[model samples]
Target: MSDVKRIATRESYGKALVELGKLHENLVVLDADLAGATKTAMFQKEFPERHIDCGIAEGNMIGVAAGLATTGKVPFASSFAMFAAGRAFEQVRNSVGYPKLNVKIGATHAGISVGEDGATHQCNEDIALMRTIPGMVVINPSDDVEAKAAVKAAYEHEGPVYLRFGRLAVPVINDNPEYKFELGKGIVLREGTDVTIIATGLEVSESLEAAKKLEADGISAKVINIHTIKPLDEKLVIESAKETGKVVTVEEHSVIGGLGSAVCDVLSENYPVKVLKIGVNDVFGESGPALELIKKYELDADSIYKKVKAFVS
Candidate 1:
């Protein structure tokens, strides 16, 4: 186990992209003119020749990325969550998803975490949108460590990958950087039986905190960090739901078609449990601090703890 630290996953992308650029000369990074914000500027600085800025045209950027992927070059396309998923959806589906192109979409500024940017810039629905695209592997890492692992894994994996991370720093729970990352695996952060809290992205840390609080309250909550939303670990979810008899799904994204919906889908087909979902309630978010925005949408640990108590009681 590695000593977990507190850092935003987006910063990890900035670090990992630079590291990757140093290792592989063929590893090209494409940015939709937001290299700095998307954290690809580090790569650009390190490998000026390999990094391409497509000037905010996300659709064209995806097409170029797909073309590069076909030529046996690993391309990490960087952009905002909403533009990458919304503007490039068709191109991503046909060019990348259909052919299973080895293109990594490093989407930053996801959810209400893009605080003070308002609803238009906030992309709480990115997860639900990207997860539905066939052949696209959706990964929402909890912190810097997991983000680095996911970036490394996505580079070697052959297919379309959507790696979403938040803008602000958060508590890191994953201690093992040397730990191998599996594409469709879920990690159990804490063991319990009273209730199971399945979470992804920034919510994973929140879930861990919630579990600790629940433990203090005499509620043994099993917390699972569901980094991979697409190709979800159905077996783990079903088994956890069975053991707990009640489950809570948490994420930075909207409740619909995101981590919560995915977990519910698995449970609904298998062992049905009383589920309480903690996320953005299908609404756009306004400008504020990231933590405040999360609290506004009830995506905080205290909310998760309270909901779990209600469900388990």
Candidate 2:
């Protein structure tokens, strides 16, 4: 795992923006003075005129993006997840979501992976918040390849889209040629029958690794990568839950109102499977090394393997 090539989704977001900018003349980017950290600087470097820095005002930035969308400009509002989703909640809900504007939010530095920035900047609640907005498409891409695909998909889609990207460099899992990126689809990475492990964002690769450990212990675990959360792949989730009879959802966000809750919402009304959610257990993240925080929060592969094993037995 250590030797595997790793790239942060934030970096992928920037590079994707550059490629999109080249194709779409109406594509415009707005950032709240964190271009370098959020990796929107790559887009700024490529298209100086198309990039607009809102100078630290996240709420205003959202309003500006909404305005740009009104005039047929495809605007991508970029910022840290804390500000993009948390600070600009009112503006996003009213300005972009209410009218169902064609706005793409590139929210980077999401989850506890933000590291030394602490709870103030590490936004575990963004997914929950964004999910509440009507007609808002929520996407949390797993790796570099998926992140780039998601950015392009968001641009093509005709409504409000929230894209969550991580600061921590994670392994590239979906580098295969067969990997396809659809707006509201879930990809089954590994299939099993004991328990279904549904994960999003940075936790996807970890869930895949955990599945291998469960296999070695005679416990089969199906791993599913759910990139799109709002319009969740209910069919795939229900089918997998019915087959496995047990479900475990892993995420870098909180157990409450995140991927775990989303899966529970679908299964409870449809399949009614027992589920164990692996995530930040309703607590704020502390300042620490990114990798150390993941281990401390028990979201690493080894920790997930143990938790899923206990749940199965």
Candidate 3:
């Protein structure tokens, strides 16, 4: 097996928070007793004065973040995705989303990759929950570099934002220094004519690998990295769908109300095309090794390759 460096998005988020803290003195961080797990400890260590540990109260954390935002402080509130989106839904919708506060929700350990945490901890519907809130900028980064850059973008953004990071360590796909991350824009990783693979989060790397396998089989595949789910790149999605004629959406979240559904909504309204959605199929996640769960849920690279091949054939 070829060795490629792997690091969790949560790790990147933690490091980026510290980096952002250096540049923006007004940046503050809050964690609902998951600083270590969410990797917010990195920022906590560097800027303890600005970090607040909310002691497992996810809802309270959101409330505090909103309060801070009004004081002109950019608060990055974090918790496991399950609590951040589920437990604090009302608070986020009412306090942050309603007022359009400048708070950032760093939801870590999202998707089936939370591994041994079982159904209760693995939050597959966070993206759906986040996007429903009006004016909430939803971002699910694909890798370490993208996740790092996304944190900075969220900090600079004016309104409420949700940044989803995975628990599992994934390969660095956007290692190119020239790669610029723009909110609401999709990046085309590979261009092809047969089909387009639009993916986000940890699934983006899998889609890229699947594209390589597809090429060996004489099938051309286009891979588009969609880091931002809300305010999606409708222009790029329409153009790619028009060119390739077939589209496949891969995401680590539930198939419903996530990237797949979002992309289909764009295509159906504009340029109609066939779309194969590869995701959790609206089911809860179970406990297992992260990689094992990935294969079982049909989100692995081999599974993605097989599914895409069958779709194209």
Tell me the deviation in Å of residue 276 in model 2: 0.5
Better of 2 and 3 by TM-score: 2
Give the local distance difference test score of model 3.
Answer: 0.95
Q: Per-residue lDDT tens digits of candidate 1, residues 135-208?
A: 88999998888899899988888788999978888886676655556889998878997888899988888888
Q: Per-prediction TM-score, please?
A: 0.96, 0.99, 0.99
Model 3: number of clashes?
Answer: 0
Ranking by lDDT: 2, 3, 1
Count the clashes in each prediction: 3, 0, 0
- List candidate 1 stretches off by more than 4 Å: 1-5, 177-180
Please tell me which model should have the higher TM-score, number 1 or number 3: 3
lDDT values, one for every candidate:
0.87, 0.95, 0.95
lDDT of 2: 0.95
Give candidate 2 regions above 4 Å deviation.
Answer: none
Q: What is the lDDT of residue 5 in candidate 1?
A: 58
- Tell me the tens digit of each residue's lDDT in model 3 across 86-172: 999999999999999999999999999999999999999989999899999999999999999999999878999999999999999
Error of 3 at 103 (Å): 0.4
Model 2 clash tally, residue pairs: 0
